[model samples]
Target: MKYSELHGNIDRGFNVFLLILVSSIVFLLLNIFFYKFQDNISYFE
Candidate 1:
């Protein structure tokens, strides 16, 4: 029983960490794209 509880906790922690990591990467990529587009607009002007 104790082992199962520990395993469950570990799985939950890993899943949470994975979700945060994916969200951060997506946000970072979006911000990078936004900046790139802004720079292009300014350059065109």
Candidate 2:
């Protein structure tokens, strides 16, 4: 019983970690895309 409980906690932690990693990657990609778009608009002006 104790081992199962510990394993569950580890799984939960790993899931949270993965969520944060994915969100950060998405945020970075969004920022990069926006930056490039802004640069292109400014160049066209």
lDDT (tens digit, per residue) of candidate 1 on 1-22 = 9999999999999999999999
Q: How big is the positional error of residue 39 in model 2, measured in Å on the Cα after superposition?
A: 0.3
Model 2 residue 36 CA deviation in Å: 0.3
The best candidate by TM-score is: 2
Error of 1 at 45 (Å): 1.7
Residue 32's lDDT in candidate 1: 100
lDDT of 2 at 17: 100
